[model samples]
Each structure stands twice: as C-alpha cells, then as structure tokens.
Target: MIKIYHNPRCSKSRQGLSILEASGKEFEIIKYLEKELTSKELLSIISKLGIKPMDLIRKNEAIWKSEYKGKTLSDQEIIEAMLKHPKLIERPIVINEDKATIGRPPENILNII
Candidate 1:
C-alpha cells in the first residue's frame, strides 16, 4: 500500500493527490496537519526518503524562519521541529513499502508508486 502525507491546502499536494487518483491504485492519505506525526514516525519517513531530516523540512515556513532559522540544529532537532509543526514539513510525501519521495513536482511520486 502507498501512503501520502498530504496537505490539502497546498497546490502541489493537491496535484500529487490528483496524480494518485488518476493512477487508479489504492493509497492512503495522511492529512498530517490534523493528525500530526510523532518524531519516531517522521524519522521513519526521513529514513525511507533517503534524506537528512532538514531535507524534509520546509525551511521557508514562518515557523522555521521565526524559530529555527540560523540555528545550527542537529538532525534530531529538525525532525522534532517538524513533528511539532507539521506545516514546516514539505508537502506530498509519498511512501511505498520501504521507499518514499517528497513529491515536489508531484510527478516524483510516480517513481515509487
């Protein structure tokens, strides 16, 4: 099964969802905002994405700029921040088995699913 950490308000996330719908494959949508992920859960996602914690962060988000920018945070700290502020997480993260991708272009999700 495929799981999409989706934010409906985000256009990119919506596009990714549209793509998944068009694909006709069953998938799960995790509206991460309403149901925030725990640190361990996020860590698992980051691992599956094959990226550093910061790579999954939306550095431009207000939460990041006001509180986390210019701070030399450890990987754990960044992941924790995202867990605390799901909006600080990038949009449309798709996971399939052990593989995952941050679907920036939305099309990137195709690679895994």
Candidate 2:
C-alpha cells in the first residue's frame, strides 16, 4: 500500500494530499506528528528516499535553526533530532512499495504514484 507522511497544517502537505486524492490510487495517511515516528521507522523512510537523514529534514524550521543549525552531526544524531522534534521532518513524504519521494512541488508525487 502507498503511505503519505503528512502534516495537515502545511500547505505543501495539503497540496500533496490533494494530488494523491486526485490520482484515485489508494493510500494511507500517516500524521507523523500525532503518531510520532520511531528512529527505526524514520530511518527506513530515509533509506527508501535514497537520501541522507539530514536531507529529509526541514532545515528552515525554527527548531532546526535554534537547536541543530551549524552543527556537525552524525546521521543518527540528526535522525534523533527529528524524532524529538517531528516538526523538523519534511512534510508529505509519499511511499509506494519500496520507493518514496518528498512531495515538495506536489507534482513530484505523480512520479511515484
């Protein structure tokens, strides 16, 4: 099944969800903030995205700027930070089978779904 890690308050996330709905393919929505992702779960998503853990972070978030900016952190440390502050995670990560993509432009989801 396809899954979307979404934040309803984020415009980009909402756009992504709309795209998925329009696509007419079945998908699951994971409200990561409400459910909270574990370190292992987040790590697995990052792996599917074929990106470094830091690459999946919302670097401009206030929490990132205040707590983790300009720091040389290990991949595990960065993942831990995201777990502690889920807001630091980038929104609308869509996973289809073993493939995943960050729906920054919303259209990006079309490539996967």
Candidate 3:
C-alpha cells in the first residue's frame, strides 16, 4: 500500500494529498503531527528516500533554527531532533514499497505513485 506522511496544514502536503486523491489509488494518510513516527520507522523512511537525515529536515522551521541550526549533529542526533519536534520534518513524504520521495513540488510524489 502507498503511504503518505502528511502534515495537513502545509499547502504542499495538501497538494500532494490531492494528487493521491486524483489518482484513485488506495493509500494511507498518516497525519504525522498527530501520530508521531518512531525512530525505527523514521530510519526506514530515510533509507527509502535515499537521503541523509539532514536532508529530510525542514531547516526553516523555528524549532530547527532555534535548537538545531548552526550546530553539528550526527545522524542519530538529527533523527532525535525530528522525533522531538515533528514540525521540523519535511512535508508530505510518500512511500511506495521500498521507494519514497519528499513532496516539495507536490508533483514529485507522482514519480513513485
């Protein structure tokens, strides 16, 4: 099944959701803000996206700027930060089996879906 790690408040996230909806394919919408991702699950997603932990972060988020920005961090520390502050996670990550992509343009999701 396809799964979308979604933040409903984000326009890009909403746009990604719309794409899924228009596709008429069954998919799971994970309201990640409401249901936090566990470390194991997060790591799996990062691996699937083929990106470093830092690449998955929303660097502009106030929490990241105030707490994590300009500081050196290991992959685990960055993962911990995202776990502690879910808002720091990039929006609308779509996962289909072993493949995943961040929906920055929202259209990026179309590739894997």
Highest TM-score: give the candidate number. Answer: 3
Model 2 Cα shift for residue 5 (angstroms)? 0.4
33-75: candidate 1 lDDT, tens digit per residue? 9997987788899899889998888888988999999999999
Q: Specify the highest-lDDT model's number.
A: 3
Better of 2 and 3 by lDDT: 3
**What is the TM-score of candidate 3?**
0.98
Off by over 4 Å in 1: none
lDDT of 3 at 101: 94
TM-score of candidate 2 on Cα atoms, chains taken together: 0.98
Candidate 2: tens digits of C-alpha lDDT, residues 1-113: 99999999999999999999999999999999999898789989999999999898888899899989999999989999999999999988999999999999889999998
Global lDDT scores for all candidate models? 0.91, 0.93, 0.94
Worst 10 residues of 2 by lDDT: 36-45
For model 3, how does the per-residue alpha-carbon lDDT over 24-74 read when each residue is reduced to its tens digit? 999999998999899999999999999999999998899998988899999
Model 1 steric clash pairs: none
Ranking by lDDT: 3, 2, 1
TM-score of each predicted structure versus truth: 0.97, 0.98, 0.98
Clashes of each: 0, 0, 0
Which candidate, 1 or 3, has the higher TM-score? 3
